[model samples]
Target: MTSRVLYLFGSAAPPVHDIAAVVRTAQNRGFTVCLGLTPTATDWLDPQRTELERLTGYPVRSRYKRPGTADVWPKADVIAFAPATFNSINAWALGITQNFVVGVVAEGIGKGIPMVTMPCVNAAYAAHPQLDRSIETLRGAGIRVLYGEGGFVPNAPGQGRPPAYPWHLLLDAAEQAASTP
Candidate 1:
């Protein structure tokens, strides 16, 4: 069988710092990984950008390409938008595609790709009423969202432990998505 490509998108949350390790783990599971980041995440990881490309064997994309330009990454077999920020989660649900990460997911929904998202938001931001609506919307669309009890529970503001983000559960969900037929 051909390799399964996992398109991993991230936002500017602290867990975004652990993406390199996540990519490595994804690769070990036989996924040909492609990485996309929010603009702020791109800047935050600028120093490791080159190394990330080396690790994934694909450019780390943060913005849209020119209209006539070809897409460099393979077609995604599964998508994981982990470490999703409050803004990205809402934007994606609302079809706000100003950025590449949100744009891909917005379109990805109609393309029938299995997608998963786990927010890295804090308790303070999680309290916003819109967040629950957004999560339901995505889940209503068949996207497997890892939040609340079974998944990520928002930590108190200023108390986030980025290193402890549930990378394993996210990966497991992605693996399941790829295998579901």
Candidate 2:
């Protein structure tokens, strides 16, 4: 069976290259990618969104407005938010779904869907009191937060590479989660 993967992008911290790599790798593994981007991320990546849509064959969205009043949104098998910003993380943990990405995440969480959030905020923001609480809340709500090798950071100088065997690790985790009875 094909797995539907939702790629939620926050700001520029996590690096567009990382997001694109993950999406491409997931696609090669028979997973369909649906991109949900934040306005800041859109600004940072600009035309890359179009390239992503072409690669995934699905429309990319950065707003909360529905496609059509009567149209139903597509449900995803797995929701993965990469480079989640501090604002988005806090909003999501607090049940704020004003945007399309957060809305889908809130709905998915309520439905007991598996979610993986890779936050890419600077060190100071990650250390903030509210941010820590938000991260804890996300964890408390059963969301998987993938911490990169070095740890969470608000802004890294360059696009850091995922650990070796990143795709395999993600695939294994997804498979294990799917196998739960």
Candidate 3:
């Protein structure tokens, strides 16, 4: 069976332009990519959601279903939070499951699934006291939080973009995590 990669997107800079490449890269790696978008991310991706679904052969979800609604997607083999924003990072770390993506992350932790998170916040935001603790907490829980070289490094706040964020790094990390014992 094909491994399912559940990609959770937050409102971060790279995703605004690089999401298609990310999806294609995951598919190339032999994953069935399912997208879970944060509300803000969904708003940003609304124009292309249809195209994205076409590319991945699955729907892009941002909200929870109504009561009695059936889940239409496959169970995730590996879950990745890409372009993980400061808000999303904090929310997930704090156990705040107010949104679909965050809720999935919270549940993924309990499910004992291999998971990876690639944060895309800038230097100033990354410097927040909560961010370090959050990353530490996540790492402590067996979540692979990819940062620094080969992943994301904080750019100066307001500098308007860091050196091209390594979107591919997320795919590699997720695959590795999924395959590990």
Candidate 4:
């Protein structure tokens, strides 16, 4: 069976370093991966777009197509939102689909496709009143949110650096969520 995993990139510190590893790891685990990046995330990965497309055998989409145009990617069996940032997390929870990545994820949730989210916010950001509620809302929608122990935890702001991103954990959580009934 072919498991098509749509990996959505958010503007966070981790994916900038771990995207390649994430793709390779998922592929090794029998997933056919496609990439969708937030506009800012796409800017960060712009130089590697061609290489990343080559790696996944699918184009990296960061923008919506013209109204009459067709989608360039295959139907996704699972959606993985890695390095999900504070802004993206809130935007997604509020059903704001201004960007391609969030739009796809929102629609996927409505369709009841298996979905996973690995947030990469700092402690200050996480403390925002809306953040916790947003997470709870997403979890209520059946999204497997990878947070706290064994997943992502907040760091101190202005640290100027981050610990190793848990890319493997993101894929692992996604795989488990996808296997759920």
The most accurate candidate by TM-score is: 1
Instruction: List TM-score per model, in order.
Output: 0.98, 0.78, 0.92, 0.92
Per-residue alpha-carbon lDDT of candidate 1 for residues 78-181, written as tens digits (9 for 90 to 100): 99998999999999999999899999999999999999999989999999999999999999999999998889999998999988899999999999999898
TM-score of candidate 1 to 2 decimals:
0.98
lDDT string for model 3 (36-114, tens) is 8888878878888899989988788888878898887877888888888888888898899989989988888999988
lDDT-best of 2 and 3: 3
For model 2, name the residue pairs that clash: 121-153, 121-154, 122-153, 122-154, 122-155, 123-154
- The total number of steric clashes, by the backbone 3 Å criterion, in model 1 comes to 0
Total clashes for model 3:
0
Root-mean-square deviation per candidate: 0.7, 3.6, 1.7, 1.7
What's the TM for model 3?
0.92
Q: Candidate 2 lDDT, tens digit per residue, 1-181?
A: 6565545445455454556777777777667777777777777777687787787777677876555565223666667676677788888989887677787787777899887776766666666799878888888888877655633434443444434324444444544454454
The alpha-carbon lDDT assigned to residue 33 of candidate 3 equals 83
Cα deviation at 57, candidate 4, in Å, is 1.1
**Alpha-carbon shift of residue 171 in model 2 (angstroms):** 5.9
Global lDDT scores for all candidate models = 0.95, 0.66, 0.81, 0.81
Q: Which stretches in model 2 have alpha-carbon errors above 4 Å?
A: 65-73, 148-181
Lowest summed lDDT across 10 adjacent residues in model 2 is found at: 157-166
Best candidate according to lDDT: 1
